[model samples]
Target: MIEVAAAIIENEQGEILIARRKKDKSQGGLWEFPGGKLEPDESVEACLKRELREEMNIEIQPYESFGVNEHDYGSVHIRLFAYKATFVRGEIVLVDHDRVEWVRPKALKAYEFAPADVKFVELLERE
Candidate 1:
């Protein structure tokens, strides 16, 4: 299984941040939490921080893991680790995703998510 990191990134207005993937990405054009693959010897929190920094040009304090989701996308299997985090600081830099949006928790369900993110969204809704 491929280990992945994802964030339930929240903003000051009590909204969550979701990124729209570029058409070439694995789950191209779908909305997903900002994060990436976990590197060797890296803590999951560190992976979350590194991914946000690289993918979105942001710094975040990923204090804890709140949920996990697993899914298969035909070729590869994914193990997504979801974290509950506050946006500590960042400039809106779109490196991988096509667009970024600050959306309400309920509004998040409207977007198409990768399979693993479907369950993650349910966890978000439960909050």
Candidate 2:
């Protein structure tokens, strides 16, 4: 099973950051809480920080454990760890994703998310 870390990065205005997967990638064109798979032996917090920096060119301080979800896409099974994080610094840059957006929690349902990430949207919306 692949271990993934996803960040629910909230800005000062209380908007969360979500990214759109590149059209050619797995789960393509879907919006997801920005994060990535964990490197071997890496802690979830470290993985979250590293992934956000590498993929989005931003630094984040992961402060709380939001939730977790496991899903199988037939080809691959992933256990996703969601963390509540604060955007620390750096200019936003898209590396693996096509676009990024800061959206209100209640508005997240309007975007189609990867299956594993769908649970988080419902969780956030109730907040």
Summarize candidate 1's per-residue lDDT along 1-127 as a digit string, tens digits. 9999998888889998999999998889998988999998887899988899888889888877877888988899999999988899979899899999999988888899877888878877877
The lDDT, on a scale of 0 to 1, for candidate 1 is: 0.88
TM per candidate: 0.95, 0.98
Model 2 per-residue lDDT tens digits across residues 8-88? 999999999999999999999999999899999999999999999899889999999998999999999999999999999
Q: How accurate is candidate 2 locally (lDDT)?
A: 0.95
TM-score of 1: 0.95
lDDT of 2 at 16: 97
CA lDDT, candidate 1, residue 93: 92
* Winner by lDDT: 2
Q: Pull out the clashing pairs in model 1.
A: none
RMSD to the native, candidate 2?
A: 0.5
* Candidate 1 residue runs with Cα over 4 Å from true position: none
The global C-alpha lDDT for each of the candidates, from Candidate 1 onward, is 0.88, 0.95
